[model samples]
Target: MTRKIIAMAATVICVLGGFTASASSVAQDNPTVKEVKLRAEFYQNELDLLLDKARRGNFADFYQDVVKFAHYGEKYPQYLLGVMLLKGDGVQQDIGQGLVWIRLALEQKNTEWQKVYDSITAKLTKEQLDALEPMYETYKARFGVQAQKMSCNNEKMEASNIRIHQCRKTLVLKEFYSVYEYN
Candidate 1:
């Protein structure tokens, strides 16, 4: 699981190579960037645990963790929370809310998520469809990428003493890795 996350990080680093920074630069006195990295690491760790629990079929615990992660503007957890809500896995079934969560995740522009979004929306009832707009607006305002300030725009990642440029170039070259490989 940890390996999978690392591989995913590596892949994202590759795709976001333009955002890479020198280790020395990242180690400088930029408190805001430092804070963002710290928060990202903390959330990533929590997300790893949550994913592990989901893999173990601990839906109840997974649901609780997903709620927290989704609130923190994590896309994958928001998608999972939506699935849970749609099926009432650990909470009451709420189609509208479920769609909203999936919509939020899809807004991040992940193609895989789009498949899920399309399939679900294709079968929605009239009331469910009606509820989507307002709910989507509300969740979007609070959990959307822009609101969360999620951007790959020159964000620094920890690479110890290694030059981020070389490291990212290598990782990006091998695009076969999937974060969901283990799952």
Candidate 2:
């Protein structure tokens, strides 16, 4: 009786395995599945080619490919291309354009890339800094007055009649006069 039960169980298991294998084969023949598999294959092929170029230190080829990938508006590719440009590893050194791309990457709010963005910004020029003024103004205008206000508040204790906020974000005050005194 035990041998009969074991044989029955083996038969059931084989039947279930055969059904699963046939079902998977049918699914694989579905047009949608075929299309998805084809697209995945193409994507992987392109990725592999790009990685191979990068590994070979063929930066110019990799850079151009990256630009093409970036033009597709892929955020990670844009960030990588910007980093390459900033470092002058492959493409021409264009800090301004690199900052633009890095800013675009940051605008996606990808916190993972924030360190790269910050590192690139640290090496930016005065001109690049000036160029971001419009972006700051736009953000302030869109986000409201509170966003524009410097992020500092201090209790006043006057030393020699001057009240200092000591905020790092504040512009250097060329001249300071109270509103009442100025008026």
Best candidate, TM-score? 1
lDDT of 1 by residue, 88-169 (tens): 6778755557667888887556666677667555554465466467657656665566555454222234865432211101
Clashing pairs in 1: none
Q: lDDT for every model?
A: 0.55, 0.45
Off by over 4 Å in 2: 1-40, 55-57, 107-112, 122-127, 130-183
Alpha-carbon deviation at 67 in model 1, angstroms:
0.6
Position 5, candidate 1: lDDT: 27
Candidate 1's clash total is 0
- lDDT of model 2, residue 135: 42
Model 1, position 162: C-alpha lDDT score:
34
Residue pairs clashing, model 2: none
